[model samples]
Target: MNCKSLQPAAKKCVNEDCELHEKGFAKYFCNICNLFDDRPRPIFHCPYCNTCRMGLGLGIDFRHCMRCNACVSLADKDHRCIPQKLQGSCPICHDTLFNSTEPLKGLRCGHVMHLSCYNQYCRGQNYTCPLCMRCMEDMSDYFSLLDQAVRMQAMPAAYQNTICNIYCQDCEKTGECRYHFVGLKCTQCASYNTREMGRYEQLAAFPN
Candidate 1:
């Protein structure tokens, strides 16, 4: 049924001998089915979702996203869209995200996770989206510090010219960089968020 046609149940019951009428339990009435309920006030039925949801009403606090097939906050109308983004489980907790009551946070990569989970994950020093392994926030300052640290450290005599293959999570590219125990910087983006593929080949040792 269209949500506009669904009316709030009546507050009082007309049945004289009904238990709800005697105890004043009937506080809402479903106009379509002629049923009374004591659930709560301000409940709304969403035609798009085809379910009764607790909120201020559709288009007031939230709106339905046809692409995601879920109701999202009105404030997030311009949020980045990922195909069926809300239809998956939280990456951290592995709990269902659709219709979940917990607050959610969206990442730059267009991934979503429970707000609490995001906080805990950040507190654990993880700054990338778990699903895509992409940097979730600007890491320019952090990467600059790594650059300074790498510059100050000198490689051992035997490995001075050593180079290694690395795949960068930030740039999503594979390249080679001078081998350093601190971290391998992406040759393309100069980001230290990279993993060594393996030691390439050793060359003539040279001073840094």
Candidate 2:
């Protein structure tokens, strides 16, 4: 496409009514209006089409939702708290969310919390998830996963071995143990602490 030929996807000849609206290929300026939809409406409840394409314009950069498994098309510091359909008290304060301040913040574990509660939960030591315990660096990743975790997953099998199983120092139970080298998920014999990890030691396999 050429830079001289572009328009709103909603108006162009592109597949969805606007192929000419190919981003960057054209000015993306409305001919008569001579301005972009600065608000870039998500087209939710479009009376013209009588359809709601809420997620159509969303991109990877869209902020992750502080509560549910969705994304917010805004930045963390600028996130707007809105009524969410998901049900749960603020994870940090355990306060009812029906009328309380919305938890417009998120944890890597997907737990939702109000910004104030999140800070207080960490006791000013440095706020993070009570469950994941992942330290918060910048406000940006407050709702996203750490990059390193994903990088490790890309390693080969040699990097996928379980070194040992963790156990309670005194309980002598494998329930609390984690096989870091092998894997994280515990078999039916036990439940790995998804929210928490425990100490471990090498042990022989049990007889089937």
Candidate 3:
């Protein structure tokens, strides 16, 4: 559409409802989408996405992942299947991640986290999901290290026979095992984040 023709000498249009009457095509604008074009080339807006997108002559082929609650490449529909609903804060940063403006990094276990938060986490030594104990990506080296540690180390004589109740974060199972300085190991999944429970306290999964 010829936006210049819409801008009268009075810097307004006869149609008061038209947004261009107030601001006529500032630099590069799309009358159809009613947004400033950020790219050097023309862009189109997907009503479903409610955001601008880029494409060649054919048009962008992005698809929204309902589970992820975000737009993804058309070819990448088979993402890690998260059975639960997408809601609440990020497991890593404790910030609202669902329906957030920031891009997300989906894990194989079906949980989604901020891309920036994930990058920052990768800078550390560990490589496991913060919410679940499942490995976020390939951690064969880390797993091997843990295996060697478990094999080479032994519990102290004092705590060697003391039985303790524990809960597994990954498998959501409970079992009893001997305690050690390293950590309480879950008999189910071998995750060390298990918490010791008192005789009165019933076994329960940690709050998500």
Candidate 4:
């Protein structure tokens, strides 16, 4: 067969001897970069955010890419589709319930769906949990916000742009992980700096 006619085989990226996992989009990139490839060649990290994610071996029953059109990034409520600012459509299913000004719940996973629509979806799939399908986890956290007459602590508008955050030196998770802003500190002092963007982090820890 001609070189162009032959399709590349699906090879597992790890040593699990399984076929579910495969190389991410790029094949020339390394799994990690820590004094590994400094010779002057360019490195490809990830598609969305390049970080030289190489040598990051895969494991059985694990996935790195799901092509999820998560609801967290949208055209409303910082594109997060908060129930109060849902103004877009679901990229995955293209639901039209997002274009509303009233309280409309969009999934935290970037799926803009009506609260009722999601409930109906769950009801049909033998009540399968919406996220990850690993059985529903306790979700009283997000729902409690919907309860009226709930006197929640108020965040000053000054902190609307604030991004309270932390950077764990261990695991380098704080800097590497996206949610590191939860416990971030003041760059000028030892006090907890609620200033994300070092200027606008509006949320405090939800439960504590």
Candidate 1: tens digits of C-alpha lDDT, residues 1-208? 2223333454444465555445653555445445455766565666776665556778898787787677767877446678788778999999998777677888877889999999999999998899999888778999899888888988786677788888998788998788988888887887788888888555565333
User: Local error of candidate 1 at 107, Å?
Assistant: 1.2
Q: lDDT order of candidates, best first?
A: 1, 3, 2, 4
User: Model 3 scores what on Cα lDDT?
Assistant: 0.61
**What are the clashing pairs of model 1?**
9-28, 9-29, 10-29
Better of 3 and 4 by lDDT: 3
Report how far residue 181 has shifted in candidate 4, in Å: 40
Candidate 4 C-alpha lDDT tens digits along 1-208: 1123333333223433333245322334344432234344333333332233322332322123324322232233423223323334633255654333223444433334555666666667532224333223233343344222123434455543444344422112232111232334323322221223323343554321
Tens-place lDDT digits, model 2, residues 87-183: 5677666776433424355654445667688767667665445644443434335223323343355535443333434442112244433234323
Alpha carbon lDDT of residue 152, candidate 4? 45
**Local error of candidate 4 at 159, Å?**
56
Indicate which candidate wins on TM-score: 1
TM-score of each: 0.68, 0.30, 0.57, 0.20
Model 1: CA > 4 A from native? 1-65, 70-78, 202-208
What order do you get sorting by TM-score, best first? Answer: 1, 3, 2, 4
lDDT of each: 0.75, 0.43, 0.61, 0.35
Model 4 ranges off by over 4 Å = 1-88, 91-93, 101-103, 108-110, 126-208
Off by over 4 Å in 3: 1-33, 38-47, 53-62, 74-78, 81-101, 121-135, 138-140, 198-208
Better of 1 and 2 by TM-score: 1
- Candidate 4 contains a number of clashing pairs equal to 25
Instruction: Supply the global lDDT for candidate 1.
Output: 0.75
